[model samples]
Target: MPTDVDLGHHGDRDVAPGLVDLAVNVRAGAPPSWLLARLTGALGRLAAYPDQSSARAAVAARHGRPAGSVLLTAGAAEGFVLLARTLRPRRAVVVHPQFTEPEAALRAAGHEVERVVLAPPFRVGPGLVPEDADLVVVGNPTNPTSVLHPASTLSALCRPGRVVVVDEAFMDAVPGEAESLAGRSDLPGLVVVRSLTKTWGLAGLRVGYLLADPALVARLQQAQPLWPLSAPALVAVEACSAPSAVEESATWARGIVAHREHLAEALAGVPGVDVVPDARGPFLLLRTPVDVRSALRDVGFAVRRGDTFPGLGPEWARVAVRDPDTSDAFVRALRGALGQPAPAGDGGRPVGSVALVGGGPGDPALLTVRGLQLLAAADVVVADRLGPTTVLDGLAPGVKVVDASKTPGGRTVPQEETNARLVSLAREGKRVVRLKGGDPYVFARGWEELAACRAAGVPVEVVPGVTSALGAPAAADVPVTHRELAQEFVVVSGHVPPGDPRSTVDWDALARLNGTLVLLMAVDRLPAISAALVAGGRGGDTPVAVVQQGTLEGQRVLRTTLAAAGDDCARAGVRPPAVVVVGAVAGLVAG
Candidate 1:
């Protein structure tokens, strides 16, 4: 049909709060102090409508065109809408996978648009466009693809009856503004659109301009509303077009070149990650083996999804170029997402390594990005029953899975055997993953496995998971530590009763503390534990909550007082693999 692409989806949608944004291509820390000062000073003039004469002239002079040839717009986006409304063409074509706004704007204005989807190395040529197409839209240093088409190639698309609109929105980010068509006035029907948003980091300001023949500019202007741009936006347009601002952008463009190269080189080295070749823009297009956007998000980084753009699929992503330090860290996180290990050190360990990953609160989605990566790369996985077992379904067909589950009063995989298996796998030059429930070190005997791997001289790493002790309480809407209720939380093993000789915990001491108590593996011992707390001066009526199968589909919460916790849990058929929270905050959520 009509390409089946989400034309309205942009990179900004890929970003969320608490994430390092690599999705949006806008330069970070933009609108330098000087530009900010100019815009700030213009705020006083907002009482009056904006005057575009000065701004239009400034843009005209910057590109060596007459004032009549420049049309100041609210932003490059508005320019697309203006052109889409003003131009009447029998056949309109848009080149992909570039910016989608042009096609979207045209479609929104009740116009039919065709797409010339380019293959890898996305280089455009005159042959790609149909001769009968009267209107064509393309981007120089295209978005998502980051491929910069030659100026001659774009000019070749222009003819007497055909209109070739070149979007140079990101041209300023390219060193020396290479391959730009803003100054080409002799080419008939050539309209060059330039935006100040990306380089100036003024995306919120909405300032840009289009350069075309005087007649076309006037026609487009007629279609725009009066006072189309704000005063501050008008000031930004004039100030950014100044020669001094141009020179400053040139310097920043050179810096972008360096940062882009650093990011490209590092990404090229990551396994299963393919960086699109010859990236000329400030961002790079990446093709990954699987859709790792969620994994990357889990790791606190946000990347633009490529499937929204025509000619690209879900496996493709767009990441912005950042400083070398940030690029390096991103590369490392990327390696984890792809289940690859860090480069070997001077110690020259074998390619094989062991990673202890926490599966987190029984939900596969709750697993950390690093944990997912290790599991993906593992040749052998030793997993616990309480961990995210469903994740094993996604593993490669060849991966070997071992059940190391421990059942109460039943068959169990010995701790000693689990440790030996990890060491043996690594020694056999296998990438081994020891996956456990919650935090691996939280009463999981993960340290013992680490010790065994180290004793065997096998390189090892740990990817901490969300421990159920805390995750379970939160999932049940029970705050372990509340300012007015409890300021501290104590997590302890409840595998043994209060008076059991094998127990290491001092029940009386724990009872004396007025804080939240989180007990793991304590369902069978709740009677003795509650009695000990009550006998040790703690109130019997203290609130208690048991969260079973926390974060899983079958998760259930049983609420009661400490004195009745044992009977209530027994009657409710509560089981192990649950977190028991004891404190005033436990009863905050009503049954």
Candidate 2:
């Protein structure tokens, strides 16, 4: 009963205003003129209660079932809740990563639901479900996974005491409705739930029906309210189940086959993207090295987040099929988000590109998603010593790793040489990643590389990371600013001694302020800096804390007063890349 997945999350939540929606599986340009006309004509009959006689008979005739076997509801969702409330199965099993409402409804009704999560390729068969499960819920052409289970496989799940509930919500989207069991009345304890929401685009109308044996249908109908379907909803359901509407839906379903293939093929061609094979639904299930949902949103598209499903994680996303033009644009945006170069006009080959990525304080996990994507697609990585160096070990074979680390008082790569290399590699048609430590703009000289790439006419992107200046102090449990102690915090570089001619900082002004002062690259000149601040009308007893190698292994923290900071750090052998915090908040954490 305790699970990490949020069963109530649905695809419509992913859509936002002004975004191209590829999250919901509803067919585009739906509720054709004919169906809309019928619903509009029925609106005048709102004075009368909804009569399910004609709609129920139409659905029964459509599936070759008797009227007693049909139970029309508000929607397929209502049908799921009705069943969850009515069934008293001792062992209930839900096959996922499919639609989540069944599990959610069962749990809401105080039923203990067990999940039979199918693995990748996401195929469903007989032995996958528990033999003792008296109630089984599955989706044909499942949501998120988009893998349609064979009719034979699902039929094999039926037993004398078991209730096999098959959700065929999107089955009408399948050409010829192949693998559909809607008309199979001979199977024992079989319940087929169908919806016109996706293909007919009547989701707002809330029209659907369920077919089962007469006894089971009567039991579920008792759980429903009086005249459950609305007058307009009943009209929509009756119109959608007609023979003419069925033929029209088949034509639309055939078009989806082509559109889905086009989108899947284009996405599969993208590096690091794995498409779930044999996707028979109107959407696709995709897995990538990094979560690209946010990246895709940046380019004006909304996709379903797959983590809400039982067996999927953040790396998975579900994208609906659209027209060829929309699919092409989506693919281009996806390629850009994944750090792959845009296709050139000639032969679709990738063009040269450069990305300035912030690797975040020495911790690979702290790297941004955009940065990780660029690293995965890079042909050349120009890395700094303080960056997440360990992550480079996971790069694919044949990826050229260039050492551009700046060592204090040792051999170093010149800034000019590094800039030149970035432009040169990009000119050679290589995807170049200029990886830096911490926030690239936070004393990392990343603007220089951006300028060089721009001057050389190379397409470039900048991905910001967590800066060590703030991360280090927080890692040591020291807040740079405390509401009662210090209301403001200033971050400054201490590469130059306080009194040096090259120093741009005004030590006197800093000492006059009643706030926290965070110093970076100041370990070597701590004695002079501390003395200068003390001489400038500042208390020698001001609290000071030093954090070294923040957010990584081998991190060290030292707490002292301003007067004793230099002596304490010297005795403790504190080194470069440490952040120094001065003010009352520095002593908030125990020494």
Candidate 3:
């Protein structure tokens, strides 16, 4: 068993910037727009003191209990604290691998807390619990393990003069709310603490309630501070308890079950990743190498650690079951972190289609919504050096990564071979993502690959991304076009020298224009191109700015005139994958 010192540690602390969150198990997106509107409407009422009666009645009605049987608290966590303060149990027993707040609360109030650590499968049995324990706290569809104890097993723990607290914070995520005691009013000493936070995506609002005997509810209510529930929280309590809200929750719960099963199956197939069987919660419990969590974090993923829970070790982790796309992305990251090979799945079905996804400049955050979705679903990701490869760190387990970077003067995978690989993978029924840097169409020869795919009769989807030619200037606070400074902006490739017969850009015409010139793939040719502009009637003193690896952590920005732009870039050894801006707007540094 692990030490109890960090029993209070929660999942939120595992989250950080740029990481795909599997640590916190809140709903995927924001609270629904209607729910947001409801919360927003309640803000105007904050001037008044909280009125708990309406919320109490709503919750009671939702649970099919008397209004007197409900006691609203700041959240389920606060309800645990209240129980610790109010109940004077002769023996306190808490189930292991469950939410730790109840046990922590008990210990804080000077009670010697006993832990009944369940073994694998984590099912609660009569012999496992202490018969003499007067108080027991457990989570239905328990956290970190996602095991749902039968309601009958919970009822058996309710002895006379004893209080049984069931934390069902995630029960709503389980389809049918199976094995949940939230609506059970016939049982004695059964206190069901329910959170509106997870299902409503209102963790910040802190609204929850406990359902128990009216007498016990009154006793717990006595321990609460005056107006413990906020006015807006109360409104949430009421709104979420409405019949329509309950129906919507049930629908989401069903969807969650499907997503969880899909995620679990995929994870189970990954080498070195084990999904706990019969998981019924919104999150899945996984067992892997002890170092896997930190490794995931290093690759832009945040996953909850399991060591804080008693009976679990450093090898354990909890991952929220999200939509299929995100689940796919997460699984890929897991496999990459573990260095595992692809899993063998059913061979009868045709593999999925392919998408040429734009990875968007150098920043993973700039990936388009559709691109992210397609990337998540990809079974094989053929990535480029210029694309945001960090996102590949979040790919689902069993995903194959093919490096297709076309480095000049360096050994690289031939374009034809890459195209053939993509077509073959798609024909084999794999969801393939040809991830490229910036917008695939912006000088990426993506149209050529798309043409090959169409010729081979392989289905393909093109998801556009933020081009660095535009993203770079914006990142450096240098606008390509500024009002009264530059009226138009042209983005052209600098891969070919100005005098090269293959070059399509007319240097003379470009120099004759007064608009901005944004160049991509031009770092190596900067000197020739700058001189060509100077010789073609363009002013030698025209402002020029070079942004290298723009929007990335190692991004660098250089400012100089057109005459010195090429010479200065060469002197500084600026690399390719750089964006160059030339025009009056380049000189207009934003304040």
Strongest candidate by TM-score? 3
Over 4 Å off, model 2: 1-3, 344-591
lDDT of 1 by residue, 120-230 (tens): 988887788999999999999898799999898898888999999999999998888888999889999999999999999999989898999999998998999999999
- Candidate 3 RMSD to the real structure: 15.0
Ranking by lDDT: 2, 1, 3
**Candidate 3: residue 586 lDDT (0-100):** 87
lDDT of each: 0.88, 0.88, 0.86
Q: TM-score of every model?
A: 0.60, 0.59, 0.62
- Cα RMSD (angstroms) for every candidate in the order listed: 16.3, 18.8, 15.0
Better of 1 and 3 by TM-score: 3
Model 2 vs truth, CA RMSD: 18.8
Query: Which has the better lDDT: candidate 1, or candidate 3?
Result: 1
Predicted structure 2: lDDT:
0.88
Instruction: Tell me the spans in candidate 1 whose CA falls farther than 4 Å from its real position.
Output: 1-3, 345-591
